[model samples]
Target: MRKTIIGLDLDRESSQISYYSERSMEPETVSIQENQDRYLIPTPSDLFTLIEGKVELGQMTLANFLKTCIGYIGPSVKPENVCIMITMKEITLAWADALRNACQMIGIPGEAVFLQTHRESFCCYTLNQKKELWIHRVALFEYEDTKISSYIMDIDYHTKPALVRAETGKSINLGRQGARSQEQWNEQRDARFLEMIEEVFQNDTFSAVFLIGDSFDKTWAVESLQYLWSNRRRRVYQGRNLYTKGACYAAMQRMDIGKRLDDFLYQSEDLVEHNLSMQMEHRGKQSTHMLINAGTNWFEAEYTCEFILDDTDEVVIYARSMMGGEAESYSIVLKNLPERPKRTTRLQMRLKFISQGRCKVTIRDLGFGEFYPASGKVWESVLEV
Candidate 1:
């Protein structure tokens, strides 16, 4: 059976979905309307004007729409082999769990449903692009509801998974339909707006900038567009489907199939898309062991490994970053044993990815035979690299 995956870009204002299939060979944005030729579907509470006392099944609403999204996407989900990914601005744990449950009912593996913040989709989209685009810093300007958010995609060749960090959500009052709508308005406000944008971009250099939002048209942002075009380092791309396409890229990354990663890992405030592993020696021989695999959603990245303490009390784990740079090695200290012989103390080491910034490491001592009962002592450490 062909693999099917859905990537959902959700926010309170609007939501979009991009679906990929083994047969299609490319990702395409899904249209929610019955007859309209559009990709994004508005979920405003007031959009339900067509129906009266009877609420329509497919009627989109802020409340019921998000809750039933999993079931709504169920038809696109393949039985036994499928994946569902949701990228949102913010979601409660309860809603995420509900999504997981809905996935389970449709035969999708509980672990296959990936949840991440929206900026992560931005990082994934940019990082997955050809490395040539990363010559300098990459940027994205999102204009929504009279507000502008500027996100700078930071690239660090040093870090592994979270190499791409987004610095964004900078807002200013380019108010709705004010001076921008007036064709013969005074040049004073326009000049100040241009100056404000120049100040924002004065200190930074961007290789590529993606302009997104309904207000991005020529009519509304003539001066701002002129400023962006004149001062930009390279090309400035515009579109409403970038995030949804980026989400699709993320979903494909999980399938371990069509998506190609030249050397891209999407990492954000609460998401870690890279695996953490370690190289160790066993019985006078050297071997590699994987602790956490990449492409795993950070919320579900908790894993435990129990092993008896070796001759040394120190354990070292390396985050094998793709491409260049030395692997990041984190040495975990397993201290305060029962003062017994080597290999007598059994230690259970657990690595839990707490946030994009760090991973929490917990090491507990589980004893060997009857003579050395489990001591119940533990050592905790944080891997912030």
Candidate 2:
């Protein structure tokens, strides 16, 4: 039997789940209601708020909730063969850890659980569609709780491994805060939505547009709906399962189950854009050694190395952009060091990212096996990429 690949759209308010269907070969959204199209399962109001205080309790609650969700998949499914991708509006290192802990409590391996942002989920969903649907720019409009948001995605084929970028755009409060009547609010909403569409679509050609939300319909968006479907002449679809389906696709992509997106790379906000390396003597020859690699999450990117100082009191790290550019070197000076023979001073270097464009570097002096004696000294610096 094949492994069970799953995508879960987890949020504070509600959650949705999708699973890759072996028979249909597509992600099918799980409906909470037996004979309805409902996909949302109400989440606990205090689930996220309590994570800041009682961490263990929060993780337990999350694990129990996830266990309930997994029960809906099937009785024959095994936890060892499940791969789950969790996508949210935004993910911090703390939340990522909590989610992974929850999965671990439920017998899921750490390697089988993944986390991503909604923007990446959007890219996965769009790129997985037919080529014609995403050959050009793709637009997405999401309406929720009287608010509307817009996002645009572009692909740069000029780059090797085609870069896919999705950015959040305009947002507006379309709720009936001070409404005269339903009809008046609908009319005003239609006009405002049309203006927003014009602002985004002007002087740009989009191959497809997606509307994500539960409340979107033709009743209030008659003019805007007609404009998007007819004037733009692009494929328009409305649904609430895009993110979950995209999460499923992300899992599939990570597991090498699909080749549709093998040539594309999605650079999300948390990804590192530069490669960190240094020159070191290895096996009697000088070579460039990688310290931290590009395309790694900032929170998880860290490296440690031990080296002998050849003839300098300074440690240098080279940063090279992934987009093809000259490597820039940043140096950290070792201060108040004990006089030692050449190549006799052993040092330990540690590098870690604080954010996308910033990193922290520390070097500690470790005397060469009692020959030079220990100085117990440490040097710290920050590198801006």
List TM-scores for all candidates, in order.
Answer: 0.64, 0.82
Write model 1 residue lDDT over 259-374, tens digit each, in one string. 57656555554555456877666888878878887655566677788777678878888875433366778888766767888778787888876665477899888889798998
Residue 191 in model 1: shift from native, Å? 4.8
Of candidate 2, the 10-residue stretch with the lowest lDDT total is: 47-56
Model 1's alpha-carbon lDDT is 0.67
| Overall local distance difference test of candidate 2 | 0.86
Q: For residue 189, what is the lDDT in candidate 1? A: 39
**lDDT, residue 176, candidate 2:** 72
Residue 306 shift from truth in candidate 2, angstroms: 8.1
Clashes of each: 0, 0
Model 1 residue runs over 4 Å out of place are 21-24, 44-76, 91-98, 130-133, 157-162, 175-193, 231-233, 271-297, 304-385
Candidate 2: regions farther than 4 A off: 33-35, 52-56, 177-179, 278-284, 299-317, 329-352, 360-383
Error of 1 at 236 (Å): 2.2
